[model samples]
Target chain A: MSLQRLAIAACLLPGLVACVNSTVDQMVFNTPGAGIGDASVVILGRRHASDYETEPEFIRCVGNHISSRDKSIGVVGEQEFLDALYPWFEPRTAPLRPADLERLLEHRDVARAFTTMQTRYMIWIDGSTVRNDSAGSMTCGIGPGGAGCFGFGTWSNDANYEATIWDFSKRAEVGRISTTASGQSYMPAVVVPIPIIAPVQGTACDSIGDQLLEFLSAEY
Target chain B: MSGSMTIGPDRWLAATLLVFLLAGCGTKQVLVQSEFPPPVMNKLPLTIGVWYDEEFANHEFFDEAAGRAETSWLVNTGQAQVQLWDTLLKGMFRDVVYMNGKPGPGQMNPVVDAVLLPAVDELQYAIPAHTNVKVYEIWMRYRLQLVTTGGAPIADWTMPAYGKTPTAFMQSDEGAVRLAAIVALRDAGAHFASTFTSIPDVAQWLASLPRAGDAARRRVQP
Candidate 1:
C-alpha cells in the first residue's frame, strides 16, 4: 500500500468516535501583588436568573481543579461559604457588584464574619453546559435467542460560562474570564454497541480554572 | 406412573396475570425537614413575639397535577416552617419570644412590643414529565403580618420564595422533593433577612419604633 493510504487507514483505526473543542477568553483590568499568600478564594455559582440555575456540581468541579493545582491557596466550597454566612450570600441576597460588597460589609455581623475569613477573592460563575445539537438513533431489541443494538448514534454538547472575579479585600472588580467548550460523542453498533462519550463540561471547567489561576495568583 | 406432572394452562394463565398486577402506591407523603443557619444582619432592637396558629403549625400542601398519572404529593412544611421562622426571627431581632396564643381583646399573650405572624399563603410544585432534565421545583408565598401587642395591624406583606433540586439523577422522588423544600425554606430566610426593611410599610413601621430612629435614617438603603 502507498504511504498516504497507510496514513489514512491509521487515522481511521480508532473510529474517531469522540472529540472535544474548547476555548478560554479572559480580561485583566488589574493584576495582583508579588506572590499569593495564605488567602482563600470561593468559587460560587450564580442562580439568580429565573430561566436557569447554575449547576452546583460545576462550581465544585472548578474549585477542585483550582485547589488541586496549587496547594498554597485555599479553596472554599460553595455550600460552605453560603452556609457559613447564612442568608447573606444566598441567591436572592448575594452582592452583584463590588459596590454591593461595600454595603454588605456595613453590617457588623456580615463585616466581622466576612473580613475574618481571609477570603481575598470572590469568583462568581454563571452558565451551564447543555446538549444542544444531536442526530441519529440506535435501536435495541431482545428476543428468545439474543439481544443486540444496531445503528449509529451521535450527539453534541455546548458549554458557555463566565467568571466574574471580585477582589473582596480591595472591594474592587479585578477582571472577567469566560470560556466556551463544545464536544461531540458518537455511538456505533454492529451487534454490540460501542459507546463513546465526550467531556464537554469537564473541558469548560479546565479552561475556567486555568484562567482563574492566572487571573488571581501572583506566582504560578 | 411418570415422576413429572404436566402443568395446566390455568396455572400458567394465573401466574402471568399475577406478574402484570403491580401494587403501585397512589400517594407520596414528603415530610419536609431541614436545618437553618443564623442570618447576618443588623438586629431590629424591639422585643417581639410570634404566634403560630394550628393551620400554620401543621402546614401541608397536597399536589395533584391535572391529567397526569403521577403520584399525589403531600409535602408537609410544618416542622421546617417553625424551625426556619424560629431561627430567622432570632437572627433578625434582639429578643424573640414564642407565644402560645394570638393577641386579642380577651386572649392572653406575651408583653412584647410587637407580634409577628407568618403563614404559607400558597405553594406550588412542578416535576419534569416531558422535559429533558429531571428537576423538581417548589415555590412558596408567605403572608407576613406585623401587629401591635394589642393585635392592631402594623404592616402586612407578602413574600415569595423559590427553590429547585440541582439534579434529580440517581435520586428518588421523595429525596428530591425533600431537598427542594429545604432549599425553598432557605430561600425564604434569605429573602426575609435581606428585604425585611425594603418593604414600604414594614420599613415605615420599623422607623416608627422609638428604638429604631437609626433604622428610619437607613430605611431607604438597599
Candidate 2:
C-alpha cells in the first residue's frame, strides 16, 4: 500500500521543466529622411561597410572626446554618415515586372532612405566594426595617481548603429530604435575610470526619424 | 548571652533567605519561531541549440529592385541571426533557443530563445560554492535564422560561444541595481571588452523562503 501511494504521488508532480527567460534587451528603430527642399530625401540605417571591422578604434575614440571639439565634430559626422543612408524596403507590387522595379526604386520614401545629404559626399567610417580589436581596454590610465589619465582613450569610445524600418500608414517609416555605446563603462579593467565616455546607436525607429530629418534637409 | 544572640541572628537569616526564594523564578528565552522554511531546489532539465541561415534582413537591400515591398512583413529566420555562429558543433543543447524562424508581431530584433533553468544535462550548469547568494552558470550553444511562413529563408547570421555562456550575470534579481549595472557594463564593454565589470553584492541578496501552513501542528509533541 505504501509503495502504491508513493507511485501515485510521483505521477502527480508537474515533471521537471526549467524555462529561462531571454536576457538580451533590444529596441526597434527606423532611419529617417534627409536633404534640402522638395527633393523628397529619406535617410535609412545601414550597417557600416563589411570592412567596418577595420575602422580605427583610436581615431573613433578621439572623436568622442567632449572636451575636444575635433572629436565631438567627428562623432557628429559619423552619426551624420549613418543618417544619410536611406532605409531598406521591399516593393509590394508582386509579379516580375520592370515597371514595378522602377517604381520601387522611385518610391520617394524608399529613394530618400538610401541617398546621402548631397550627391558628392564622403563616409569617414568606411571600415567595418566601429573600433579596433583591442579598443575597449583603455579605461585605466598608465598608473595610479596618473596625470591627464586617459583611461578609455580615443579607441575606447566608439559607437555603432544597426537598424531596420517599416513604413507607417502616414507615408512615413516607424519602427523601434535600439542603441548601444562603448566607453570606459564598457571596460572590464580595475580602477573604474570616472566620467565615462562611449559611442552609441539610437533605436531603429528613432534613428529613422533622425534620418528623415537629414534626408529632408538635403533634398528640399 | 553571646550564644543566644548568635542563634537569634541565624533564625533571622533563615527567614530572609526563605522569603527571597519565594519571590524568585527562572528567566525565559522567548525564541519566537519564524513561519518560513529554507528554499528548496526544483531541478528542471531543458535542451537548447542554434539555427543557421543564408541571409540577414538587410540582404533584401542587396537587390533593392527585388527587395522593396509595402506589405506588413516580419523577417524570415535566415536574415535574423549574427555571423559568429557558423562554427559551432551541431547538436541539440538544453536551455537555449536561437531565433531560427519568423518572429511574431511586436517581437524585438536579435531574436532569442527562451531560458531553460535547472537543466537537463549535468554538464550544462555549475553552481560554485557561495559564488553569490543565488548565482548559477549555464553553458549551451545555438544558431540563429529567420524563415518565412511558407518555409522560405529570409535572413541569416550565426553567433557561437565556446566553453562559457556567451553572456554572463543575466536574469539576476537585483531590481534597480541590475538596470544600473547593465547601463554601466554596456559602456564599459564598448570601450574595452576586457574592462567590462560587474560584482555581485552578497549582503543584500534576497530570496523569498517557503512558509509552513500549520506551525502548531509541526511542533514535536513533548
Which regions of candidate 1 fall more than 4 Å away from where they truly are? A1-17, A139-152, A189-193, B1-25, B130-135, B211-222
Which runs in model 2 stand beyond 4 Å of their true positions?
Answer: A1-35, A38-40, A47-129, A133-192, A195-220, B1-222
Give one digit per residue, the lDDT tens place, for model 2 in B1-222: 355434675587689879876534322111111111111111112222333333332222110122222112111112211221221111111144554443445534343322111111111222222132222222222332333323333333332221211112233222222222222222211221111111111001111112321221122111
Which run of 10 residues does model 2 chain A get worst, by summed lDDT? Answer: A86-95
In model 1 chain B, the worst 10-residue window by lDDT is: B213-222
lDDT of 1 by residue, B1-222 (tens): 669888897788677667655323356789998788888777777678999988888999997744545567799999999999999999888899887678777777778878999999999877665354546788999999988767889889899999887553487777887888998999999888778777787767776777765754463235
Across A101-170, the per-residue lDDT of candidate 1 in tens digits comes to: 8887777877787767788889999998777667888889866578899999888988899999898888
State the weakest 10-residue window (summed lDDT) of model 2 chain B: B195-204
User: How much TM-score does chain B earn in each model?
Assistant: 0.84, 0.17
* lDDT, model 2, position A105: 42
